[model samples]
Target: METNGKILKAGIILIAVLVVLGYLGVYLLTIKEPVFIKHYIEEQIYTGYQQGPRQVDLQLYYITNAGDNRVVSRVDFPEYPEIQVPASEYGMHGGFMTYTSGPQQTPGSVKGRYSMRTVYLGFSFEEDYYEETIEITKAVIHLSDGSVVETEIGSVTFHFDEERSEVLESRGGSGSGALETREFSVKEDIELIEVFSPILPVIQDSLEMKINGRDFKDIEGMNIEAGETFLVEANTQGSRGSQAFGEELRYLKFQPKLRFISEKGTEETRILVSGWYPIPNYEFIEIFQYLRQKGAL
Candidate 1:
């Protein structure tokens, strides 16, 4: 009886040891490694001239390894610098409203693409014009590897126009008071390329803009009336190449400024706009297809 009991006890110990070893092996195999995120800006569009809400569109791309490796949780873009202008200038003001987009969710394996839309409010005046460039300095990506990578993208130019009409005796208005209407068209010309190790430039084949504008209210204290509307749009393309691991780089940064100048009764104003975007590879391919269809290639 004593011998039989000893054999049973030994067998139980052996099974327990095997189970522990199996668990350890599984844990090691499931361990995750740091992943590389290739970021790209697909498209950016801005429409600044409108009595109603202006619009801005940003398309972004995120790429990673195709496995249970580390995933991208958050991407931190540099804050757009503040623009300080006096309130008394032009008796008008301009700014942006709360923008909307899908919640920044966890990145999946392979690639993830997203688009964000922002609404802007133009200055309160009969007519307003604006011109600016959107530049992205660098994007700081947080990885499950407990690592952060800063990468440089590029810049793009944008223009804005806002027009309002005074109620003439012909139009329906009380005592020459004009009512604003939402109506405008946008035309854009943009070319963008991803500069990795080997630089290759790709021009945008399509130059037609098809974005419209909507009505908005005065959020800023600029006491401006709503009227006519205008729109802005940018269509871009991107390609990928190998990049060196460590290198000094200069990224496009967002630093917006507004200046009102009046020379000899000629009034002029300058506005600055900046942001970041990521274009997916499929979208880039579609751009080429579009160009070829139009015989632009």
Candidate 2:
């Protein structure tokens, strides 16, 4: 009976020790090193035709005191420096708008990833880079233990375009390029005169207008009533006249001489007509296809 009792007590102690060891091992595994959490930004950006002082918003996120919970030493963006601009450098327990629950918030949940310290850095790049897309290659993080880790995080491509510029294509999100409507350059005191073309550049002095899909020459002297649209092509000479005929980057302007009679028997004239549009060439090129075609990856 005594031997049997000793064996039972030893079995209970062994089971308890195994359970404690398993818990310790799992706890150690859960205690992960602070990892960088990069934000996913838009791949397509737009800027003006001309270049000037510009800014790029870059960010990095990480857990400060992860497992052992120690304060982070420093964060550096060696590729991009904060230009002369007033912005937030870094914040503690900030910019964590995602699933952020931990001992402080919830009873027992992991705190990191979405709920992390945010590091926002603004810097300028070369003009050519802004012309197309900005690529992020690497980023460095310095831990509290004086250990430095370099890693790549999130999507790295960014695009730029001016407010006036229009996007012809997009792999990112909606832009002014999505707008397809008959934008009016000039209209007499009429209620429903509009350009028929979905994308009209600008036209000036003499113009080739297509009325209802018919060349204006074919329908010369045709009296266009209200609620009608027409396409106009400039014939006036300008600096961009030597370029593409209807795709010039300059404004086409002229005096609106067309006269209209109102319903109340009053005569009104179109004062002026002008137009200007710059299609964006800031398109995204497929790097893989380009490299494959060039025989150089």
Top lDDT prediction, candidate number? 2
Candidate 2 structure, TM-score to reference: 0.34
Could you tell me every candidate's TM-score relative to the true structure? 0.28, 0.34
lDDT, candidates in the order shown: 0.29, 0.39
The digit string of per-residue lDDT tens for model 2 on 1-297 reads 999999999999999999999778445333244444333333333455556656655545543222343434455544544423222323223423334465333211123311234455555555566565454545666655677777655434454544421111111222132121122232222322332221122332224433345543354334443443333333323334323333221221222223344434444333212332222121112222222243322
Q: Per-residue error at 182 for model 1, in Å? A: 22
lDDT of 1 by residue, 179-220 (tens): 112222211211111111111121221111212321111111
The ten-residue window of minimal lDDT in model 2 covers 165-174
Alpha-carbon runs more than 4 Å astray in model 2: 1-23, 30-32, 37-39, 43-52, 56-58, 63-65, 71-117, 124-129, 163-297
